[model samples]
Target: MQIKLIAVGKTDDSSLKELISTYSKRLSHYCNFSFEIIPDLKKTKNMDESTQKGKEGELILKHVNTSDILMLLDEKGKSFTSEEFSEEIQKKLNTGMKQLIFVIGGPYGFSPEVYQRANQKIALSKMTFSHQMVRLFFTEQLYRAFTILKNEPYHHR
Candidate 1:
């Protein structure tokens, strides 16, 4: 299955971008992986939090397909160990999924519509993380998961 990570906004830090790129390249060895960045919403100064979330949700939904399994990286979502995450990835590959899309929403989080559209939700950690930092962390975890799946030494029990 092709795995896609869709995050709102771009990472401005060169270090973080480089790290994310490294993991992304590593991931290509194990599976088809794509990282898509949605441009940050324009003219947010006049909009309320809910309005901004709604607009962002609309953009997020545009990238998804009806057949794709959408997962949101949400604060309230379920957290998994590295092994468990690898098993989940294996399950998707075994099931012959076309695309597994995981999304990181905007600063205000996802709207109700986005939440409803998601097939599942996953949380990286209980503590809050910046949107940009989360991209790097998530990419690393994805690489780790793939390594675990392949019985590689990159991940340890």
Candidate 2:
């Protein structure tokens, strides 16, 4: 199955962009991996949090297919070790899923509609992280998971 990470806003930091790109290239060897940056909402400073979420939600929904397995990277979701994450990835591929879409929402988090549509939720950590930083971290973890799956030297047991 193909894997895609959909996040809001572009990475402005050159360092972070380079790191994310490095891992993304590594990931391509194992699975079809790609990223989609949903542009940050204009006039967000004047809009309420709910309204911002709703606008972002619409963009998120547009890219998702009905058959895609929607997984949200949420603060309240379940956390897993790298090995377990690899197993979860394996399960999805084994299930013959067409696409496994994982999303990292905007600053205000996901809308009610997005939450309702999610098939699963995953937490990277209990601590909070900036939306941009999370993209880098998540990309690294994804690369590590694939390495673990392949018994590569990049990941340690």
lDDT, candidate 2, residue 86? 86
Residue-by-residue lDDT tens digits, candidate 1, 1-157? 8999999998899999999999999999988999999999999999999999999999999999999999999999999998998898888788777999999999999999999999999999999999999999999999999898889999974
Q: Global CA lDDT of candidate 1, please? A: 0.93
List, residue by residue over 42-119, the lDDT tens digit for candidate 2: 878889988999999999999899999999999999999999998988888898988999999999899999999999
The clash count for each model shown is 0, 0
Shift in Å, residue 147, candidate 1: 0.8
Model 1 pairs in collision:
none
lDDT of candidate 2? 0.93
Q: Relative to the true structure, how large is the alpha-carbon lDDT of every model?
A: 0.93, 0.93
Q: After superposition, how far is residue 120 of candidate 1 from its true place, in Å?
A: 0.4
Q: Where is model 2 more than 4 Å wrong at Cα?
A: none
TM-score of 1: 0.97
